[model samples]
Target: MYQLAPNIDLLFTEAGDAPDRVRAAAAAGFNAVEMWGPTGKDIPALKEALEETGVQLTAQLAEPRMQFMIPPKDHAPFYTGLDAGVEVAQQLGCSRIVVGSGTGFGGRKRQDQLDELIEIFTRGVAHIEGSGITLVLEPVNIRVDHPGALLDRTSEAVYVAKGVNSPNFGILYDLYHSTVEGEDVAAELANAGDLVKYVQVADAPGRGEPGSGSIDWPARFADLRNSGYTGPIGLEYYPTIDSAKSVRRIQELVAGR
Candidate 1:
């Protein structure tokens, strides 16, 4: 069965704080949960809640708010932040970290920026070589959410991951972003192949729960299965109703797939 990990960062906001959200997710029947960043959260309380609830911390953002991969000169700060991120992930027992290509550099050639990104991730992979941590690059949507984001297309992200050429480095196949970018989801998944390590989903048009928009959930999941991705599919959506109720349809959809 495909594990559905609710993104606590966006889903359970009504639960007050991080620990409460973690408890809420566990009470709602999720065995695993993901979040955006570790900073500003009560780490001890969050860890206690997870330990008590027996919920696995699946993934979190690496170097939140730092665009170290944007310019070659910024790599130093990125590594420093990555070291902190790795320590946080280890403390939370998470094995995956989400990375984003920062906005395109002004007046610099696109290929030049891409080459710098590849070089940055190659060094990052070497840093975490034996840490059992995988850094997954995410291509966010520029049209709807993130304007000027460098890696908006899945194909481009795949190319960068291929250039890195490390088992520790992979791409985050976010269905909502792909749909927003107007890419054929199945074809992109096939193109990504085994380089895809993480998945996140919300519906197109509105970043709501699965059934709230036009995404063909069954076909997408079928494509995911065909592509040999067996990792957790993150429900990183904003719920229009109660979070638990919003995800029921998706749970059924995933089960039927």
Candidate 2:
């Protein structure tokens, strides 16, 4: 059973107030909402609105400033950003935070970059330990969405999660990006089942709703369910049509499945 959670930022233009978006999501039959730039807004008031509306905030995009997986050291400020992000996540009752693994540059040894990611996550996760929020390292699609994202492979992300070896850290398996990154979704799921804490989806060609693109979402969704992914299937995509309508369409598709 897939639970739908809308990314408010996708409805960027039409949506005026963040609090109103929460209420709108609830009205549109969404119990949970995810926001990307909560830190840029008034966090205290945002928390109050979420509380009053009784809308659950599931996950958020971590501030992408440092090259987490890409090398070159000097990540003191990056770690500080994670610290601030974790505090906000705790306050919003959000369990997972999605972090981008910097950019991959030409000539940087792959092994050295991977080591840097592991080191950075290890330190960041330690600070957020027992805070009840887990840090999720997101492997973006270098081919399309990110072009040069450092952590492009699910296997690499899984390796980094394991290297951290803390319950406070995990990987968010976003299928759209995985497909773009050339990963066989089923195989990645099988290999990284234990380390994957959340799953998100869109599609390749359009990066819109699931069924609109070439991805076999139902088949993948079934595989994910069978693989024990009982967490929220985040609708982290830009809507080709009305955001609310697109959500309903996806909900119907999931229901039919």
Candidate 3:
């Protein structure tokens, strides 16, 4: 069975700020949680709460998210931002940091842009070497959530990961985004294979909890298992109902109970 880490940014907000959410999730029986940007958050308080609750921090996003395809493409700030993110992750005992390919610039060949990303993160892996943290590149859906984003397909992210080609670098396979983009779960998982280092999930038709949308969780769950991914599944979704009640179906499915 797989472990489920609730995205505290969206899942347990009813509990309070990030620190309090950790306590709430722990009280509710979850042993792990994922969060977004570490900037502007009370790092000391959040760190205290995580230690207190024994709740593992699965991942956090790199700060000042870069729009790489934008003009001039100065990557200095992005590298600094990632370094700062790595510091925060180290403080919190988090193992993974998520990164994204922001909106694409027009008129550039898609291949060139993809290659550019390869260079960006290749340096990112080198820049953060010895941190013992894995950089997980995420491919979000352009169809619904992210319009004009350069990297919207898992295969493309896998390509970037291959280009980076480091033991500590891989792709984050988001189940909801892949489904929204109409990619077959089994095929993409097969395409990604072991390079998929992290995963997140939400239901399609309405990015809600497992039972609230049309996604066949059991089928995808089986496909995910067969694909040989044994990492924790981050429950990254908006709760249409109470947060605690929202996770029941997914908790059951991932637990295979």
Candidate No. with top lDDT: 3
lDDT of each: 0.88, 0.80, 0.93
Q: Considering every candidate listed, which one attains the maximal TM-score? A: 3
Sorted on TM-score, highest at the top, how do the candidates line up?
A: 3, 1, 2
**Which 10-residue window in model 1 sums to the lowest lDDT?**
65-74
Which candidate, 2 or 3, has the higher lDDT?
3
Q: Lowest summed-lDDT stretch of 10 residues in model 3?
A: 248-257
The TM-score of predicted model 1 comes to 0.95
- How many pairs of residues in model 1 come into backbone collision? 0
lDDT of candidate 2 over 1-257, digit per residue (tens) = 56778887775337677777777787788888887856567677778878988888889877756764434557777777777887888888888888878887667788888887888789888877777888888888877677877888999999999999988889999989888877888899999987898888897788988767898767877778778888887888988887777887678777864
TM-score of candidate 2 against the unseen true structure: 0.93
Clashes of each: 0, 0, 0
Candidates in descending lDDT order? 3, 1, 2
| Model 1: CA > 4 A from native | 68-72
TM-score, per-candidate, Cα-based: 0.95, 0.93, 0.98
